[model samples]
Structure formats: C-alpha cells, structure tokens
Target chain A: MRLSLGPLLYQWSRDAIEAFYAERMADPVDVVYLGETVCAKRRSLATDDWLALGRELAGAGKQVVISTLALVQAGSELATVRRLCRNGEFLVEANDMGAVRLLADAGLPFVGGASLNLYNVAALRLLRGRGMVRWVPPLELSRDDLGDLLGEARRAGIVLETELFAFGRVPLACSARCFTARHVGRPKDRCEIVCEDYPEGLPMASQEGEPLFTLNGVQTQSGAVQHLLGHGGALAELGVEILRLSPQPAHMGEIIGRYRAALDGACAETAVDRWVTAPLCDGFFRGAPGMAAAPDP
Target chain B: MKLVCPAGNLPMLKAAVGAGADAVYLGFRDDTNARHFAGLNFSDGSARRAVAHAHERGCEVYVAINTYPRPAGWRRWQRAVDTAADLGVDALILADLGVLDYAARRHPGVRLHLSVQGSATNSEALRFYADAFGVERAVLPRVLSMAQVERLCEDSPVELEVFGFGSLCVMVEGRCLLSAWTTGESPNTEGACSPARAVRWVESAGGTEVRLNDVLIDRFAPGENAGYPVVCKGRFTVNGATYHALEEPTSLNTLELLPALARAGVAAVKIEGRQRSVAYVDKVVRVWREALDTCRRSPEAYTPRSEWMATLASLSEGAQTTLGAYDRPWQ
Candidate 1:
C-alpha cells in the first residue's frame, strides 16, 4: 500500500506551512496533497504559493495533487477552483462537484476527493467516465461498505485506484459558518482569521466533558483520531491502493514512518498506535458509531 | 416563483395541495429519502394517493429518492425510482449520480429535479447534472448567500430552487457526518440524522438532558423549550466557553426575501419539513403561497406582512427564524 498525505485542513502561517511541507518532502509518503481543503479565507499560502509548493514536492520525487475547496459557494471560490483545474502541472483532487465538472470539461484526469460523495459503484463508474483516475471514498464508509463497492466495481469492469482515509481526525462536516470564528464571537466575514490560533483546531467537548469534536474554521472534525494501523492487511485485502494520512500538528513524519514500517512488514500493526496522542477510533470502519472503538481481533 | 411544500403522509400531501402548494415533495417509507424517520414518509399506497391528489389539484408531485445507496441496497433505490415513475409522479428528485443516471435512462420522459442533498452549489456542478443526467431543475444547498444565488441563477443550466423556509442545516447537505459520528447513521448513508431510535431524553435534577446514543447533546433548564437534538444545534464547551458552538436551534425563513428571489429568477421556493405535522404543512404552505403570489403580482411593492411572519416564526424551531446563509452576516 502507498502512503499519501492529505491536504492541510488547518490554518497556519505561511512560514510554518512552508517549513512543514519542506520537512514532509523527506518523509516516506509517496503522494502529497497540497492546498486548503477547509476554509477559503485561509490565505496563508496563496494559489500560486500552493502551486509552487506542489512543484517543490514533485521535485522531491513526491506525486503532488492540489485539492479544491470542499464547499464552493461564491463565484470567486468557483473561479479559484477553475484556476486550480487549469494548473496542468499537478493532478487535481476534486473535492466538490463544481471542481469535478471543471476538470471533466477540461478532459483532465483527477482524483475524486473524500468530500465528493461516491457511495456506490455506479456513481464511481459515472465519474470514471469523466476522467477520474482515483477516488477517496467518503469517510463514513465502513469496511463492509467499501468491500461491497469494490466488489461491484470489479463486477462492472471499472478500474480506478482506491484511496482510503487511514489516519487523522476525520472531518465530520463543513459549514458556511466558521465555527472557530463563532467561538471567538465574530462573524465569518470580519473574524480576523482567528483559525490561525489553533494549528490543530480548537477542541470541543460534550456537556459531560468528553471530547466531541474539533472546530477547524468551517470544518468540524472527530475528537478522536482515526487510527487504522491495525487494518493494513484488511485494507490491502480489500484492494485499497493508497492510504491517506491527514496532516496533523506534530509527529506526522514519525506517523508516516510507522505506517511505512507497518506496510513493509517491519513492525507489528498494533505497535503504531503508541504514537497517536488522542484516543483511537476505528468504529466507522467497523460499520459502527464513529466514536466507538471496536475490540481488536 | 413556484412554492414547493413537503408531505410525509396522505393527510399532509392533501393539506399542502389544498393550501396552495404549486408542487409537493415527499419520500417513500424507507431509507430512499433523507427524512427517513420512523412512522414518517409515504408507503406505496399512500404515495399513489399523494400523487393523485396533488395532480388533481394542478400541483406537481415530486418523489425524493435522494439518499446515496450502498452497493448492497442499490436495487432498492432503482426500484424506488421505477416505482415513482410508474406511479406517474411529476418528477423524481434524486441526489446520487448513479440513481440519476438510472432514472434518466429508464424513465426517459420523467422530469428529474436534483435534490438539495446533491450539494451542487455552483453553475458548473448544475451543468454537470444537467448534461450528464438531463436534470430539469436543481435545488441549491442552503450554503449560498443571496448574491451567490443570484450569480448562479444568471448562468445555471437548469432551473434553480432555494429553501424559503425550514429547520436549518448548519452544514452543507450530503457532506455532514456529525450524526454518523455520534450515532452510526447519517442523512447520506441512512437518510436520517440523529435517528430517533438512538435518542434518549432524560429528566435530571438540573434539567432535561437530551442524548443521542448516550452523547449528551444538550441540557435544558427548567421551563426552557428544547428542540430536536440535532448534533450541530447542541450546546457544547469550546475553549472553556459553553454555548451553541456551531448553531442554535432555529429555522430558515426567507419570507422577506421573496421579492429578491423572484427578481433573481428562482424557479421554486421549498418548505423543508416532511417530518413536521399536517398543520405545519398547511399553515406554512399557505403563508408562503400567499407571499409568493403577492410577490409575483407586484415585485416592486412586495413586503412580507407581519401576520405571515408571525405565523412562520410561531411554528419555527425554537420559535424563531433567521435569514440563514442568505444574509451575508449570518455566515
């Protein structure tokens, strides 16, 4: 299985973002997705900067893909998506249908990101006809659901790389309202870009004080990190060509190294769990509640 | 602009039609639709009655088979499309591309309106649906502002529909997994959010605590009216402050913007509660119908009457309403 780094979902300073990607260039990840997938207001790195970083990553022998915004509401956002699709240098990850259509109209091959809901084989088949070379299934899909979809795809004679979200705090929802700005008592328009304060996102808890979600600008993420290190064999068996690890604040290189070790059979799958700081959850993979952690087999 | 009302059963369907709904949208009694609540939605027989009643009154009937079908349940969604078409419904509102593809090919003559759950926010996405599946109309998600909606309507390939009134979905449709994170089901996969089966309302010493699968969504103080326990609307602690971190319990009311919507060429205004009561359908549809007719007659002189606004607000979640994302400041 190949290791891929998903786009940065948090807001960081341009210097911090450059340093992070520069560090990631030496990491064991094979494919790197660069661009802001959360809030469009985060201009720590402009479109040109993202393109440059993508080129730098490609120069470091990493297959780079640029991801578009998950929710494109304004004409300007749509225009940004168009510009990204026209960037012929790197493969584009179409996060929303608008990006998908732009790429399809241009007849460019693209990766259907997790935000684009492809629940069944027929939907995947439709996108395949539109120049989609690979797809990351929705984060809510279970192992059984993924297995069923792949099985149907095989029966229908459709071919595309399957990339699964293997690690990170899974994004639960994206809203037009910025939760971070709301937390700081500001409207989304004049909020002064407060998301930069929390590089890992502000944590939210239930009334009982249990971790519930993380507020990352317009995106709300799972409080518990999704740890699928133990599912390496299952993923391979199910024909997942790539495993995507979302960029976190710390230990991303170490996390990538451990995933590489696990994939290479140099280490036990369970041993990789020690590196994850938050509580572990793989319940969505087990067709159960997302916050639930299934017992190890 | 047309006023599309929601109906869960035969009575609500009749009520909407009788109350001046230009079109009525509903779902089957299974996971084929987003409002897949227990004891809600229409059965096969009730759906046929709904179609007949709405059609007889010159109102169109739309069957929403909008959920993303898993491979194991693909045939169920296809069968729903076939059944809805065979029943002679005016349109089949669909979200899944595969389902849209199937409905377009199998029922070539039937009109297809893209459901809001499709999450096609831009003209390009609408063009994709229109070109790929021949979708006749598309419902824009509630994420867009008034200006964005106007911009999209200017260039959209298909007729545009926007939510005029409803309980607000804070997140973009088809993208929210908050319910699935707390429980195991979501509107995308299971066609339900915070599925009623997993909900528990406990009376505690402090207040009435509402929980979804034992996750405390909110605790209401004595005499505080509690709304449905949608995960996003729940109060939670964020950065040492407890509040409605995402959104408060409220509804979207665009009654005042009817003139602007009409001027923007919005083809339809949708009322968003199939899970609500027959009275809600009757009352809200009547109010929107009157407002829309008044707006159509004199767009320049259009102003929503206070009585109509009062009625809608009285029926809204938390007994309040906002312009939602339509107003720039709401975002």
Candidate 2:
C-alpha cells in the first residue's frame, strides 16, 4: 500500500521544519502534504518555502501536496488560499468548504482532508464531483464504516481513491475556542504562539491522572497515538489506496518503514508490537468502541 | 424578527406556539435529528398533530433531519425527510450534505434551514450550500463574534440566524467527539450530546460531582448548582491542576445584546434546548420576543429589564448566563 504523510499539525523551528522534509526526501513515503494545517500565525516556513520544498520532495520521487489551514477565518485567509491554489506545482487538500470552493472555482483538483467530515457515500459523491479526487475518511470511522463505504462504492459503479489514517495520534475534534491557547491564558488572537512549544501537543489528563486527550490549539487529539502497524493485513484487504502517517517529533521514518514492512507481510504481530508503544486499537475499524483495543472482546 | 424555537415534545411544541414562537422545530423519535434524547422527540402521530397544531395557530412547523446518517440506517432518515415533505412542514433544518442532497432531490420545494450543528463557520461554506442546494437560512455557530457575524452577512446570500440564548458549547458545533470519546453514541451521527444514560451524579465529601461514562466531568459544593457533565465543559487536569478549563456551567444570554446583534445583520434570533420545560421555553421566548420588539422600536434606546434577566437566570443551565462571545470581555 502507498504511504502518505499528512500535513504538519504543529509549529517547529524553520530549520528543523525544512530538515524534516529534507530528510524525508530519501524516505519511503509516497505522498507528502506540506503547509500550516493548524494555526495561521505559524510562519516558520513561508508559503514560498513550502512550494520550494514541494518541488524538492517531488524531485525526490515523493508526490507533494500543499494543504490549507483547517480554519480559514477572514479575507486574509481567503487570499492565502488563492495563493496556495495558484502555485499549480501540487494538489491542495481543502480542509474547509470555503477552501473547497476556492479550489473548485480556480479549476484545481483537490484531496478531501479529514476535517470536512465525509461520513457517507453521498457526501463523498458530492465532494468528488467538486474536484475531491481522493478522500481522507473522517477521523472516527471504524473498519465496519470502511466496509460499508467500500460496499457503497462497489454498488455505485465508481471507485474513489481512499486514504486511511493509519498512524499517529487521532485528531478528535477542532473548536473555535483554542484550548491550548486558553490553557496558556491568552486570547486566541494573541495566543503568543504557545502551541509552538508543545511539539506533540500538551497532554491533558483526568483528575485521576488517566491520559485522555491532547490539546493542540483548536484541535483535540487522542492521548494515545493511534497505531495501525498490527492491522496492515486487514487494511490491505479492505481496499485502502493509501495509509496516512502524521508527522511527530522523532522516529517518524521508522514508523513509516514499519507500516511498509507490515503491509508486505514480512513481520509478525510480535515484530510490529516492538514498533508500537501501546496495545492495538483498531476497534474503530471493526465497528466497536473507538477506545477499545484490538483482539476485540 | 422570526423566532425558531425547538420542541422535543408535543407539549413544548404547543407551548412554543402559545408563546408566540414563529416556528417550532422538532425531530423524529429516531436518530434522524439532533436532540435525539431517549423518550423525547415525537411519534409519527405526535409529529402530525404537532405540525397541525402549530399551523392552525399560524406558527410554522419545521422538522429537524440534521444529523449525518450512518450507512445502512438511512431509510428511517429518508422516511423522516419524506414524511416532513409530505406533511407540508414549513421547513426542514438540515446539517449533513447527504441529507441535503436527498431533500433537495426528493422535496425540492421544502424550505431548508441550516442547523447550527452543521457548523457553517463562515460565509463561503454557507454560500456553498446556497449554491449547491437552495438553503434559505443558516443557524450561525455560537463561536462567531458579532463583528464576524456582520462580515458573514456581507458575503453570503442566505439569511443569517444567530443564537439569542442557550447552552454555550465552547467547542466548535457539529465537529465534536466528546460524546464519541466518552459514550459510544455521538451528536454527529446520533444527534444526542451527553446522553443521560451515560451520566451519573454523585455526592462526595467535597461536593456533588457529575460523571459521564465513568469519567468525572464536574464537582459542586453543597448549596451550589452543578451543570450537566458534558465532556467539553468538564473539569480536567493539565499541568497538575484541575479546573473547569472549558466553560463554567453557564447558559448563553444574548438577550441583553439583541439590538447589537440585530444591527449586525442577523435576520433572526434562535434559542436552544428542545428538551426544556414549556414554562422555561415560554418565558425565554416571550422575554426575547419582547426584547426584539423593543429593539425594533428604537435600537439604541432599548433597555433590557432586570425581571427578564432574573427569569433568564432562573431558567438557565447553572443559574448563570453571559452574553456568550457577544462581548468578548465576558467570553
């Protein structure tokens, strides 16, 4: 199966950010999405720099795509979307419907990002009609959901390219009120870029200290990084065209290579277990509770 | 201005129309709509009578088919939409694109109001719906400030509606997983937020604490009121301290800012909670209707009343309300 690196959901130093992609140039991932998919204030890598990186990654045999911010708030954001759409060097992932409209009007092909909530076959059909060439299923879908959609696709006499969020921490939700900024005691407008400090986002816990969710600015992520290593065989059997792995601070390359190995059936469950820190939780894929780990009860 | 009040029951529907609500929105007993509470919503017969009673009083009846339908279970959702169409309801408040496509195709002439659960954050998404399907109005998410509301009106063709009062969700509407992460059911697919069966209220030595699906959300002291334990508004620990970090139990009270919102190009004002008692709905709706009428008389000269404010406070979630995100100082 093809591996796709999702857009960066965090803020890092410009040098480190550039180096991440530069190192990935020699890596095994098939697709790389680059841009500030989170807060718009992050200028660590300028738009032109992102385009340059796109060209460099493309030159390295990686299909590059520029992703727009999930929350496009104002006129300036619309202009930023236009700039991203005009680059023409790469495809764009329309996170919001506004960006989708911009990409559609600009005569550009696009990928349906996870934020748009493509829950049903009809919604997928509508979005695909509007230049959504490929789709990243909503974050909460289970294996049963995938099965249902695959069945729908078979009946519809069409096959849409599908990407599964196979690795990294699952993004649970986004809010207009930024919890990360709020935790830092700053207004969203003057958040001081505190989010830049938390490389993997600030882990929040219950009063009893049970790890629950991670606050990443407007986005809340699952506390445990979602691991798809053990399910490579199941994923391939389910017809996922691409497996998406989000970027983390360290060892993402090893993670990608692990998923690659698992997909090829070269590794046993014990071999994959060494790559993942937590017990497997593909129950969402199997139509059970989202938090239920695999080897379902 | 027109008022769209929510009704989870037949009495609430009649009470809403009795109190001069321009429209009453209710959902099927099934999960086809938001506010999919157990033993709430309407039966097929109640749905028909609710519409007839509201219509006979010159009040419009709008059915809510808002939640995203899970695959293989959409026939009930389809039947609800079609029944609302055949029943000649004045409108169908919708959120999911698939539901919108179905309504636009099967009941082309049925009026469609975008549910706040759709979370149409800006004008472009709102206008996209207007262009794709003929959406007439949209319930603005509570997150937008008044200035943002004015900007959205400048861009979109649809009539913009803002929440006048209700429970304030600190998170973005429609895109929440607090329920999914906590209980297995969720508002996105199931139309219920903080399902009651999953909740437990306990009295500890420190106070009364509310729990949802075994997760502690909020704790209250003796003689103090505790709001329902929604996952977002729950108290949690970060950096070794626990706080109500999201929002204190507060109802939204934009009634004091009616004139300001009216001047901001809001076409109509909405109040939340279909599960509230008729007494609460009638009082809040009556007060707001009076407030809007007063605002229309002279926008600048309108003075909010203390008694209305008291009634609002008494009827609120935690006996407290703010001009939620209206005056950012309060936000």
Candidate 3:
C-alpha cells in the first residue's frame, strides 16, 4: 500500500505551510492532499495559492488532490467548494455531499473523503457511477468492518481505491461552536483567529490531569495518536490501497519514513511505538473503544 | 408549521397524537435507529398499532432507520425499511446512503425524509439528497445558525425540519465519535451514545462519580444534581480551568424561536426525546402545538409566553434550557 499525506486540519502561517510542502518534495508519500478541511476562516493559504502549490507539486512528479471543507455551513463555504471542484487543473477530494454533487454534475472523477459516510456496497457503486475513483471509509470503521465492505464491493464489480487513516490523533467530533475560541472565552466570529496560536491544537484533559482530547477550532480530536504501523501488513492484506497520515507540526518526515520501512516488511521492534509524542492507540481496529491500545501482534 | 414529536412506544405515540402532534416519529425495538436505549422503541406489533393509531387521529408515523449500517447489518436496515413500509408508516427517516438507495429502489411509493444524522447543513447537500433519493424533507442538524437555517429553508429543494426541543447534542449528529472513543458505542455505528451498559454511577467521597467504561466523565458535589454521562457534556480542564469544556448539560428549547421559524418557511418543528416518558412527550407536544397554532394564526402579533418556557424548563435536561445555536451569541 502507498503512503498518502492527508489534508492539513490545523491553522498555520502561509510561510510555514509553504516551507513544509517544499520539504515534502523529497518525502516517500505518493499522494499529497492540499487545502484546508477544518474551519473556513483559516485563510493562511488562499484558493489561488493552493492551486499554485498543487501545480508545483504535480510538476515535481507528485500526485496532488485538493480537499474541500468537511463542514460547509455558509454559502461562501459552498462557493469555496465549487471553486475547488472547478479548478480543472487537479482532482478534488469531496468531503461533503455538496462537493460530491458539484464534481458528479461536472462529470469529474473525484476522491471521496472519510466524512462522506460511505459504509456499504450500493453507496460505493452509486458514487462510482457518479465518477468517484477513490474513497476513504469513515474513521470509525474497524479492520473487520472494512474487510467485509471491501469484500462486498469486489463482489459487486465496483473498483474503489481504499485509503485508511493510519496515523495521528483521530478527529472525534465537530461542532458549530468553536471550542478553541470558546476555551479563551471568545465567540467564534469575534475571536481574532486564535487557532493559529495552537499549531497542534490545545489539549483538553480529564479533571485528574490525564490528556483526553485536543480541541481544534470546531473539531475535537483524540488525545492518543492512532498508530497503525504495527498493522501495516494486515492493512495491505485487507486490500487497502493507501495509508493516510495526518499532518502534524513536528517529526512528520520521520513518521513517514518509519511507516515506509514498516510497509517494506520491516518488523516493528518496539521502537516504532515511540514515534509519536502521544500515547499510541489501535483498539478501534480491534473493535473496542478507540482510546484503548493493544499490543502489536 | 407541522409539529413532529418522538414516541418510544404505542402509549407515547397515542399520547403525542392526542396532544396534537401532526406527525410522530419512532424506531423499531433494535439498533436500527439513533435512540437505541434499553427498554425503548417499538416491537413489530407495537409499530403496526402505532401507524394505525396515528392514521386514525389524522397524524402520520415516521420510522427512524437513521443509523449507518455496516456490511454485517446492511440487510437488517433494509428489512427495517421494508417492515416500516409494510406497516403503512407515512415516511422513513434515514441517514445512510445505501439504505436510502435500497428504500428508494425497493419501496418507491413510500415517502422518504432525511434524518438529522444525515448532517446536510447547506442547500447544495440538500439538493444532492433530493436528486439522489427523492428525499421530501430533511431534519436540520443542530449546528446551523438561525440565519443559515433561514437561507437554507429559502433555497432548499426539499422541505426543512428544525429541532424544537430536547437534550442538546453539542457536536453535529452522525459526525461525532466521543462516545465510541470512550465506550465502543456511537450514534452512527452502534445507534447509541454512552450506552447504558457501559455507564456506572458510583457514590464517592466527593459525590456521585459517573464513569463510562472506566473513564471518569464527571463527578458531582453533594446535591449538585448529576446528569446523564454523555461524553461531550462532561467536565474537563482546559488551560488549567475545569469546566464544561464542550458544552454544559442543558436542553435545546426552541419554543421561543417558533415565530421566526414559521416566518422562515420551515415546514416542521421536531421535538427530540425518544427515550422520554409518554407524559413528557404529551406535555412537550401540547406546548408546541399551542405555540405553532398561535404563530400561524397571527404571525405579526405573536409573542413567546413565560408559561410555555416554564413548562418546558420544568421537563428539560438539567432542569434548564437554552436556545442553542438559534440565538447563540458566539455564532
């Protein structure tokens, strides 16, 4: 399976974003998802800037896909999705149905994001008919669940490239109220883009001081980083075509390198467990509470 | 605007209809719906009687088959849709794309309404559903502002329904995983949040400590009135301050927004307590019925009354209410 860099879900300065991608030119990732999938107000990189970067990345022999916002609440947000779908220069990852309809109506082949809730064969076939080429199952799907879905899809004669979220803190929830802004006692609209202060998001802890979650503006993420490197061989055996690693502020290059080694038949020798700063969790793949961490088989 | 109420059983269904509900929504006695609480929902026999009772009272019954079905349970969801149709229910409230495809193809004549779990927050998403599955109405997620709701109602290809009152969900429905993160159950996959089986209320030195699968959600002091242990509404420390980091334990009471919603061309107002008692459904439905009638009779001179607020507040979660996301100051 190929390693894919998922969309940047946090806010960062334009210079930092550009410099990060400039270094990604030499990374082992096959596909790089560009554009912001979180809050729309995060305009560190504009639409034109993203297109320019996408062209630059493609020219460097990298496959690039522009992603739309996961939550489109305003008309302006919808307009942004339309612009991304009509870019004509790059394939778009449709995160919501609005983007899906726009791409399907334009007859453009697109990739469906994890939040689209495509859980069954008929839905997959219907979207494939509507020009969907690849799909990322919802993050909550376990190994057994995905195995059954992929098996069913093959039986139905529809080919879908499957990408699984393999690393980083799993996004647990989203809302209209921005918790990052609310954390500082400011309203969503009046807050002066406080999310930029948190490159990895602010940490939410239990009353006993145990880290529980990360509150990124409107998005709540798991406190434990989901590390599936131990199951790299199992995922490949399950027909997963791509493994998605969400972008973080630090040590991403090293993280990608470790995953590449694991997929190349390298045995995880307990050193891979220390890759992420946070505790590792793989229980969701074992059909248990997502926060529980089981020993690598 | 039509008044839609939730009923967990035949008695609640009859109570809602007698209390002047225009439509009553329910789910089967399994994990086919979002409110898959123990001792809740209807059996096949009870569902048939509910449809008959609602139809006789000039009301409609809509079965909620809104949970996302994995491959193992996909046929079970299809069976639910087929059974609801066979029972002569007016509409099938659904969220899964495959289920919608199955319902549309197998039961063409049955009306389809998009459940709140569909999470279609904008007009374009609504248009996609209308084109794909012929969805007649969509229950809006609680994440939209009043202005956004109004714009959607004006331009949506299908009729729109907004939540009128219930225990508030801080995160958008069908998109949250806090429940499954702590407990292995979610509204999307397992059809429940913080499933009762995983919950424990232990009286501690401090007070009652509520835990979900050994994860301490919240602890109440003496006489602090502990609430249900939903993961989102639990207390957490952020920046050294312990508080309801996501949202406080409160109910969403949109009775005050009735006139504005009616003027926005909203087709229906949905009351949201499927796990509640029949008396709770009866009282909440009656208040909304009277409020909607008065608003319809005189749009210009309508005003919210203190009695309506008091009655709703009395039965609300945490014994308090807020016009969540409707008149939210932070939108």
Give interface RMSD, every candidate, in order.
Answer: 0.8, 1.9, 1.0
Q: For residues B1-331, what per-residue lDDT tens digits would candidate 3 score against the true structure? A: 8999999888899999999999999999888999998889998988988888899879998999999999999888989999999999889999999999999999999999999999899888999999999999999999988988899988899999999999898888889999999888889988999999999998978788888898888989999977888988899998899999998889998877788898899999999998999899999998888998888898788887889889999998788998888766844
The numbered model that scores best in lDDT is 1
Q: Candidate 1 on B1-331: residue-level lDDT in tens? A: 8899999889998999999999999999999999999899988888888887888889999999999999999999999999999999988999998999999999999999999899999888999999999999999889899999999999999999999999999899989999999999999989999999999999988889999999999999989999999999999998778999998999999999988888889999999999999998999999988888888888899899999999999999999999999998888
RMSD of each: 1.1, 2.0, 1.2
State the lDDT of candidate 2 residue by residue for B1-331, as single tens digits. 6787879899888888888888888998988988888888988899989988998999988888888876777687789899889888998999888889989998899999998877787767787888888999998878777777778878878998888888888776777776776676778887878899889988889878787777767677898777767887777888877886667788988877777677767888888988788888888888887887888999888889899899899988879897766555433
Measured against the true two-chain complex, the DockQ scores of the candidates, in the order shown, are 0.88, 0.57, 0.80
What tens-digit string does per-residue lDDT give for candidate 3 at A58-140? 88888999999999988999999999999988999998898999999999999999888988887898899999999999888
Return the lDDT, model 1, position A241.
95
A1-297 per-residue lDDT for model 2 (tens digits) = 899999988778898898788789888899999998777778998899899889989999998989987766566776787789778779888888777877877778899887787788888888878888888887777777777877887698656788988777777777666777888788877888888888888887777776777888878877666676676777778788899998987777787777777676776542344554433455456565465566742
Fraction of native contacts under 8 Å reproduced by each candidate: 0.89, 0.47, 0.75
Pick by TM-score: 1 or 2, better one = 1
B225: Cα error in model 2, Å: 2.1
Worst 10 residues of 2 chain A by lDDT: A270-279
Q: Write the per-residue lDDT of candidate 1 for residues A18-129, one digit (tens) a residue.
A: 8899899899999999998887789999999999998899999999999999998788888899999999899999999989999999999999998889999989999999
